[model samples]
Target: MVSWLGHIRRISLTPGANQALLRKRGFPERDLHAKTSLEMAGGSFIEGFGVAAQSSTAAEATVTLARIDGIRRGFAFEGAAMAMAIRDALPLGHRRHVSDLLEAADDHIYMIHVGVGWSFARLPRPLRRAAAAGLTDPTLTWLALDGYGFHQAFFHTDKYVKRQYIDPDPPVPTNHHPEYAPHAIDQGIGRALWFVAGADPNRAVRLIEAFAPRRHEDLFAGLGLAATYAGGAPPEELAELAERAGRHRAALAQGSVFAAEARARAHIAQPHTETAVRAITGLRVTEAAAIATQSRPSGHTVDGQVAFEVWRRRIMRRWATDDTAADGAGAPSTSRQPSTSRQPDTDGVKDGS
Candidate 1:
């Protein structure tokens, strides 16, 4: 059977093209699937810019960035930002030295790495290693690792790459996604933190906390996902990782559970749902599945995209409870009130589409 993403083929990455496509489709809910396919197609476009910038002279890279900047915003602002980031980082990345990429600031490297999310998978499967070589810089490792993780999770059914090493074992191929395309990307980004931190879950938590303190909770959800779906890690390790990821266990768990269900839904064969949950979160299969069921899309929440917004609120609320429990006085809540209806957080940062 054809995959969901296979249907649309590649769409134009130019802002005008996307705007026109959106208008032509009338931006209807039924077209959500097609819209997502086009959004991901931008990955190839952004990666091309990165590759072009590497081969071109500095003057050419500048020209490339300028051209990218002129394009209109499409499904997400990340596409443009990624192109720019790649343009800036190409000089260092072209050297094929991880240390050079690390010399650049974390923000620049991350934008470059995460921007390559889709292209990571687009590479001829045989060339993936050559493309990902020289990624040892710990400082910038998290983002590249996350981008690779996102690539693995988004395109493959299992964790085929471990610690900059791709398992010779091939992932079961199917046109399945664990969540909406954007959310799945986030989860992949988040999951990479675990591997980037040398597979130490607690270290991953600390890394996320230090790097993106403002967006830790949302990222923690992705960490939860990688731990769950990848398996093989000691269950206790994952459990400890979840605990250190702040007091947002419930919210983190919710994201992971929903992702598992989405993966199962997309696959033609039955998934080892319970086994994966127990391995990832130390939760029984039934309990984990229950959480997934609770997060089911409703009238207010449609699909994993909107569901993430609602789940994030739960994480904030759970954080408040943790703070209250830590101190006798209740912690001041910083989160917005749980909106019965709210749009996805598409700001193009940790929570962007």
Candidate 2:
């Protein structure tokens, strides 16, 4: 039997299915395939939240999540993670709910961490850290911030995307290494741009290009992940995205590798994943996944940098090296450095607040 609290949370927190509709989100209908793909992801997210909110146990919720097949299954697990985190953070709620779900859905750990970020976006300021308290994986916990960025960009399109507002004071844990928070959040915003542009490669490129040049690396990384993981674009479109990435191509390829690893780890396979991986990274899904795993940093931090960023840089460097060698350049550089050119600030773009 569902508790009164659970029932109330279900009704209050779960968004109506229509909320996932392109028209509802004010996103353009670029292509039928992209629209359907994004809407399906949104719907899966809602379903996951509903199932978790109403289920009595984490195991019960896991069974329901497992039934959601295809790549959409990952999104459902993400939603379920969000719901569990929210429940655990609420007053009088079970503190172990999020951790319990984590234990049950071990394979979806990455998506689950990202899902916890959704709770941060939904909860009151005081409860945000509480929601994150259960995450023990030091390296993966940063994904929650990525999720927070996605939530803000998806829900507050104008402020986060159009205006390109950066949070002056992000609501993160006191000791959560606040310095790298914006980059992680920007990665999420970049991912949201994939949905916002309706998976149109040209549109997505234009959106990322609108940001400051410095932000392009992380944004492109996010876009690569979305393009590969969510996969609405065709081979040609994927190729176009890769070409448009230019200097940030390495970042884009790195993100694709990350996405490939995430899907491979979760045991979910789709044709789009293969197409996107091949088009963007020139590697099979397995090859890209292997690269990501092999390049992963052993420690949570490396040389005073977040291991996650270090891991990403390592992947980017590998692509950079390969690209140089393929271009007949004598020796490959150690890294792909960001361009130093300044870009005109968009109308409403603000540093913070």
Candidate 3:
């Protein structure tokens, strides 16, 4: 089954351009607050760009950001502005290391990414409520933040190969996106994705030069993008749990493309659920746990485990004990019972295809 991964666009600002970006993005003044507010609020780093999509199948996974209009607006903005924001926020000067700037900054830029949202116009009566409910999910917030994190990591880590990473810089001034062929325009999708990235028009050119569907595919294949997460873990155990939850999601996609497709459909319902719970509310293990309680519309069942569950179990494994009263073990398995959901065993796990 072919998966429809959305366009995952990442723009890393060239050094020394935060203030310019502030104005482009309409920040009142070049100040730390702009960066802080976005990160704190869990906003997408790239301004003006967003994603949209609608699917009829209950089991389908496709990238939503590819929502393209014949005329593009996001690319119309200047890359220099965003680059400047990153530059000013840092400790480094001309030719200074991006890591130095990030390390020296007040708060490390967490991450930036965007997930597709439901267009009220596109939604039917039923799914519309679900779309509106998704806004509050922490996992949704996590999805939005990743692109920023990816952009910054590349911006700071890579070293300059030649003055220009692209053989020739992008089309001057105007954005040149792909036409007939995909990878052609979105070359930046791969070019900027390398070891290091910065505020170079080449990256921008590579980014908008070709906007293709396959480019998004290339990004997912290149990095093996993991499951989306929303917020922080209170303890090491909780962090582990979140990772495990994401990994379980990843594992399902890996096992069978069909099963992965189904899970992808399920993801639309996930961000909101994970957020509604204040505490860990998933299976003990992503695979093992997800399978234990997975469910379907027809009332079918599948066992499952989640990244969050695995992480939690690793930490609690030593602490957890078997229940002698039920299974004849000494203590009770805290994981077998989830605090977040009503009926732990009622639903099938992520393994359900």
Estimate candidate 3's alpha-carbon lDDT, on a 0 to 1 scale: 0.24
TM-score against native, each model:
0.37, 0.89, 0.21
Give the higher-lDDT candidate: 1 or 2: 2
Off by over 4 Å in 2: 1-5, 173-176, 322-353
Model 2 per-residue lDDT tens digits across residues 327-346 = 22222333232232322111
lDDT per prediction?
A: 0.40, 0.81, 0.24
State which candidate, 1 or 2, has the greater TM-score.
2
Over 4 Å off in model 3, which ranges?
1-41, 45-118, 121-228, 236-294, 298-353
Better of 1 and 3 by TM-score: 1
Alpha-carbon runs more than 4 Å astray in model 1:
1-186, 263-276, 279-282, 298-307, 311-353
Model 1: per-residue Cα lDDT at residue 344: 29
Error of 3 at 214 (Å): 46
Q: Candidate order by TM-score, highest to lowest?
A: 2, 1, 3
Clashes of each: 0, 1, 60
Tens-place lDDT per residue, model 3, 191-258, is 22322212221232243223332233223211211111212122233223323333232221121121
